[model samples]
Target chain A: MRVALADDGALFRDGLVMLLEAAGHEVVGCTADGDTLVELLATEPADVAVLDIRMPPEPDGGLSTAERLRADHPELGLLFLSHYAETHYLIRVLNIGTQAIGYRLKEKVGSVEVLSDTLTRIRDGEIVIEPVLAQRLVDRPSSNRRDMLATLSDRELDVLRLMSEGRSNAGIASLLFVAAKSIEKHISSIFMKLGLPSDAAEQHRRVLAVLTFLRSVQDSG
Target chain B: MTLDTYDATGSARRRADEHWSRRRDLERQLHDGPALRIAALTLRLGLLAQKARHDVGGLPHDIEELQYQLHLIQQELRAVADRIYPPLLHEAGLGPALRELASSASVRVDAGGGRFDPAVEGVVYFVIVGVLAALPPATRTVDVVIRRDADGLALDLGDVDTGQIGAVRDRVRWVDGVAEVGDGLIGTIRVRIPCE
Candidate 1:
């Protein structure tokens, strides 16, 4: 996979380049700010662009850049790396677009497996949210009486969480050591429980719908 | 009202400005220095752990423990940095920042409004957080509303006594804003700051 990165911290950028190369992904270009990432991507296109949410031009320049990049190049994957896993950044990142996007904490993404998996999921047009943030979304106390999330059972909540983490039903099934068909059943049951309008045509879109639901829940609270 | 009082307020404002800047700088240093360096090291260690796994069929327990310890340090550093200065306040604005601050508060805070000048936001955020902290342990009910009208930004704090209003007054006054206690023993503290 071809990956571009923009982060103000030079040390972290260098380390990221090394990690990506070690993970067998091409580091197309590396820069220190969102503006430079825009320029770099124009000249050197990448399948995915990893950004630090806090960078030059503005405190949340990465968000604005992601929005622009998504507008200009719809196919490009975006993964935002932040030092802190604030749900606020996750909300903004999801607002940009649910597809081919991810928000992961910097410390957590150090693992090559996690980084590689994230890039692959993004390239596959999935929304890759950090697991911790997803767990928080599940655990947060819902003030609204009509909160659909409260309807989900513990096992259902686990499925929804894995779905939010960009895991395919099959991937989730493997992790849980369940059969593929059962995972599908659990997911469909989840969508029904959450009162998500049925749209069985596209699996990824369902994941996105769940993500959008989570975002709305976060916004309301 | 008098020159002495005016100079004192000016000096106090200057001190607040300096304090905010210092906190911001310290936050930046923590963010860009040790935080980044530690993160970089974590990345390298991750790669090393992968190699160890490939060669030894699994990660050594000590290496895993070291990585866990480093991750904890990173989290601690981030918490400290957020305390020194919330990055969200600078990145996102007062509303989101206040909501983040209020999440941990025992009282309810309906943090509404939008972006204002950074200086105005700093003062309002600082004053609100300080006031909330000073609430008595037994104090149960408190209301915080942040709104912007034709005049400027206004923060209305209900159920706070006059005693608590003094610090609120000084904090708001530093930004050339007005903080007034309503007509009751335990009244609301209304603060209005002009925003351009």
Candidate 2:
């Protein structure tokens, strides 16, 4: 596959480009911003274009560019990489009039095989979603407000509902009458079920999950 | 007759003195309120402008991702300007201004029949942008819910990413507001700003 990589992060974009090239994919162009990516696409068309969801201008600026590309250049396969599993981006990806699209969390590119497989799938006309994101689609609770409480496991769901209400570990501990340490253990378990790593970015991922769940519920309603 | 005349004259002088004091007090309040408001507005705008400039320079340079971040900054700046002085709020009202701000993100906004006093709208706008500006690099989408009820204006900002919830909370608190961060992979921020 001839790939064009776009990401404002030099380190990340460089690493990804190297990975793709090592996997036998040809990288035709590299850009630090979306405008450059657009220009590259217009002039030097590639079979696939991999982009970071957020980049220069600001961290949240790349989504519109992605939409524009999907509209203008339907033949080019689109893939989005981000630090977070943003549902908004996912929905946008799903709405794009092509099936050759993919969204993956940056951390999930831990192996060359996974990245190459995703690129190939996108190039072959499959909507590739990261495993973590796929889990979200399966685990999303039903939107029936009455059944919403029942859709989650007692512990895993409690953590999620509190999370949606914007409670911290300490806050949840106080609310649930448990130790903060115990709350931490429950959260780790939740992360495992959700296919997310429990690390410094865990809280951010949890927020992303809750937002996805909420948005799904909102959409269903 | 002489005694009656003296009492009437004394009473009249006392009433005149009381009326003069009341007038002076009212005049002081009238001058103070607007002067203080103007000073506060000026200071707030200055601080916001400085912060905006700092944020622009601090923007990351992952060129592939530049367009996304650039769009976010543009949306934020517009929100900041509308907040500082809502030409829209003054003309079309709160709903129109918020709708305009929300349109930039391509996200659906449900305002819930909330109305903003012009001043409240200004504060809400700045607070929203300031919180957004403070967001760490990982956050993707920001869901802003501005509600005006018995407690004034409450802003519920839910970020699509939560990695920097602690930093976001600290920054929000520094602005003299309360931030509630939910535990999960994604983060939601609930800020309550009193109308007063």
TM-score of chain A of each: 0.92, 0.65
Candidate 2: docking tier: incorrect
Residue A151 C-alpha lDDT in model 2: 41
lDDT for A3 (candidate 2): 92
lDDT string, candidate 1, B82-104, tens digits: 77777788777776676555434
lDDT of each: 0.78, 0.57
Tens digits of per-residue lDDT, candidate 2, B1-196, equal 5765676644743454454345434433432343223322322332333334436564322321343343344344434434345444443344545444443332234455365444445444545556556656423446666667686656666654455556546544433446566788666667664544
The runs of at least 3 residues in candidate 2 whose Cα sits more than 4 Å from the true structure, single-residue gaps closed, are: A57-59, A142-215, B1-145, B148-152, B155-196
lDDT value, residue B48 of candidate 2: 36
Among incorrect, acceptable, medium and high, the docking class of model 1 is acceptable
- To one decimal place, how large is model 2's interface RMSD in Å? 18.4
The candidate that achieves the highest DockQ relative to the unseen native structure: 1
lDDT tens digits by residue: candidate 1, A52-112: 9888867688999998899989999999998877767777887899889999888887777
